[model samples]
Target: MQAGCTGCRSKADTFDIAMAFQPIVDAETGRPFAYEALVRGSNGEGAYDVLSQVTPENRYAFDQQCRVTAIELAVAAGIIDTGARLSINFLPNAVYSPVACIQLTLKTARATGFPPDRLIFEFTENEEMADTSHVKTIVETYRKMGFATAIDDFGAGHAGLGLLAKFQTDLIKLDMDLIRGVDTSLPRRMIIESVVRLCENLGITVIAEGIETVAEYEALRAIGVRYIQGYLLARPGFRTLPEITLPGGSIAAAA
Candidate 1:
C-alpha cells in the first residue's frame, strides 16, 4: 500500500464504480454456485473504463468501495434469497490491513443482510504480487473469518504452481487461454485433465471459465470439471444477474 492508503481512505477516495454480475454454474445441474461481481461504470460501462480511474493514491478506497458496491447491488438484484454465493474480485496490493480494510464490507454485508460466509474474495494470479506471505495471510484470515478465498486465472499468470502450493485457495478458475481451444487441442485437453485431478486431490474446486463452443464445454465435462463460467453459459449482466443458457437449448435462471 502507498502513503495515502490508511484506514477507510474516505477522504482520498473519489471515484464512482458499479458492478456487473455473471454466474459460475454447476455444469451437470445447471444451478448457480456463485455470481462473480465484475466492476463497471454506473451506466453499464466496461471494466477497463472504470478501472482506468483507479490510481495508487486511491487504490485502497477503490478496493473498499468495490466490496461494498458489489454486496449492496447484488442484494438489490435479488441475490439475498438465492442459495448462490457472491464472488468478489479484490486487489491484494491495495490491502494494508486485512481486518481494517474489510470493516466497510462487513458493515455493508450486515446492512444488506448478505451472509459473510456466502462471500468469496477472489484475487488474480496474473497480478504481480510483491509479497506472497502477505497474500497467504490474507487468504488464511479470510477463510478463518468464514469467507471463501479464490485465485483467479490460475494457470496463466505471474505465479502458477508455486502460488497454488502456498495458498491452496478454496477455488481456482483455470485461465481461459487454457480453455479456449481445448476441444481441438490434444495437449490442452491433457493439461486441463491433469489439473482437474490435481485440484480434486488437493480439495480445490476447479472452474472451467471462458467456455464458448459446445465442443469446449463437452471437452471440459469429459475431463470432469464440475463448475463452468463463460459466454457459453451467460454473459455478465450490468446491475443484474443474467440467465444461464444450459446445453441442449435450455435456459435456466442464474439464481
Candidate 2:
C-alpha cells in the first residue's frame, strides 16, 4: 500500500483558488454527514474556471493547494461544531506521491485542530485511472492512515462495477445520471436498488448525489441511501456552511 509513495518533485504554482462547501446529509436524521469541498475561483467562479487553469506542470500544485485550502476553509466554517466529516476531492493522476503529498494535509489538520479521522478524501471515477495499482495504493495508504476514502461519481464516466471488482472504498456516490429521475423511472429505481444492495453486501455505504427535488429525495430514502447530497439539501456555501432542508419541509442550519 505504501509502495507507491515515492518519486515526486513537490512544487507550488502561483494561482488563486478557493472552496465552496456542499453538505451531504443523513437521510434518517436530516443532519449533515459531511461537507464536500468544491473548487472555485477566488472571486467565487465555478470549478471549470479553476480547473481550466490546471496543466501537467501545475497539476501537482493545484492538487496540493486544494487539500490545504479545503481543510482551512472547513475549519473556519465551523465544521467541528457540526460534528460532521469534511470530504475533499482529489485527483489521483496528480498525486505523484500519496504519502509525500499528504504531509501538508496532515500539517494543516494539526494546525487547525481538526481530527484526522473526520477527514474523507474522495476521487471521482470521471477521471480515468492511468494506473489502477497506484490508485489502489493511495486508497489503502489513506485508510491505514485513519482517513476515510470514497469513490465519487460511481457508475459514470470510467467508474463502474468493473472498478469495484478491484477494491472497495468506504463510500460510493451514485452519479447524478442515475438519480436524475429515480422517482419516476422504473429502470433507474431498479438500478439504484440493485447498487444499494450490492454495496450493502460489500460492506460499503452508498450515497445518492445530485438529487434535486422532494420526489428524488424520497425515492432515494426508500432505496436505503442513507447519505444524500444535492440541491435538495443545500447548494454549495461559499466560505460558509449552508443550511440543510430536511425531508419533512424543515430547514436545519449547520452549526
Candidate 3:
C-alpha cells in the first residue's frame, strides 16, 4: 500500500482545516435542499489554501478528515435542524476500502447526531479514476448504506456519460461552465434542456451549479431545473451556514 493509503486508513491528522457551507436551493420553494461542505483553512482561507498542502502521504487522511470535519461542523451549524442534507465531497482514489474507510464517517455522524440517510457523498467526475470498477463499488456501497450519491461537475469531465452508464447515482450536478451565460446561449439552453429530460427519465435529480444572476436563475427555472447551487442563492459561508437569498417571486413547482 502507498504511504498515503496507510495514513488514510489510520486517519491520523497533521493538518488543521475547517469547512464552509453553500446551500443548494430548491428552485420551486426557494428553501435549502442541501448544504455542501467545502474545505477551507482553519482560519477561513479559500479551499486552495488547504488543498495545496495535500501530498501523497496525506491524501487519504485529508479525504477522511474532510468527511468527519464536515459532518462535525454541520452539526455545530445546526444543519440537521434545518432538515437539509449534508453534501460532502469524497475522493474515490483515496478510498482503500469503502466499508473499512467509512467507519470514522459513521462514528462522526452518530456522535454529531446527524442522520445517516441525510448525508450525500459527492464525487467529482473531473478527477481521473485509475479504477472505475472501484468507483462503482464506492457509489453502490454508499447507496446501500442509506446515504445519497451524486456526481459533481457532471459535464466537465471525460467520464460524463460513461460514468453515468456505470453507476446510477441519485443526483448529477451540472458544471458551472454549462450554466454560465446559459440565459443568452441558445446552444446551452438546448443542451441543458435535453440533459434535464434525460435525467428526469432516469430518476436522477439535476442541480444547476454556479448560478450568479437573476437571468441565469430565471432561465434555469423556466427550463424545469429543480435544484440550484451558487452565488445567486448564497455563497459558501466559511465555518458558518450563510443565509440563503433567493430571487424574488420564486414559486413552488406544482405537485
The TM-score ranking, best first, is: 1, 2, 3
Tens digits of lDDT, candidate 2, 145-196? 9999999999898859988989889999999998998999999999999999
Off by over 4 Å in 2: 1-12
Model 3 TM-score on a 0 to 1 scale: 0.94
The C-alpha stretches of model 3 lying farther than 4 A from their native spots are 1-6, 249-255
* Local distance difference test, each candidate: 0.89, 0.88, 0.88
Q: What is the C-alpha RMSD of each candidate to the true structure, in Å?
A: 1.5, 2.3, 3.0
Per-residue lDDT of candidate 3, residues 136-218 (tens digit): 89888988899899999989986988889887799999999999999999999999999999999999999999999999999
TM values, all candidates:
0.96, 0.95, 0.94
lDDT of 1 by residue, 1-255 (tens): 444346356765656778999999998789889999999988888899988888866777788889989999999999977789999999998888787788889999999999999999999999999899999999988988999998899898899989987778999999999998999999999999888999999999999889998999999999999999999989998899889999887998755
- Evaluation by TM-score, superior candidate among 2 and 3: 2
User: Which candidate wins on TM-score?
Assistant: 1
Off by over 4 Å in 1: 1-7
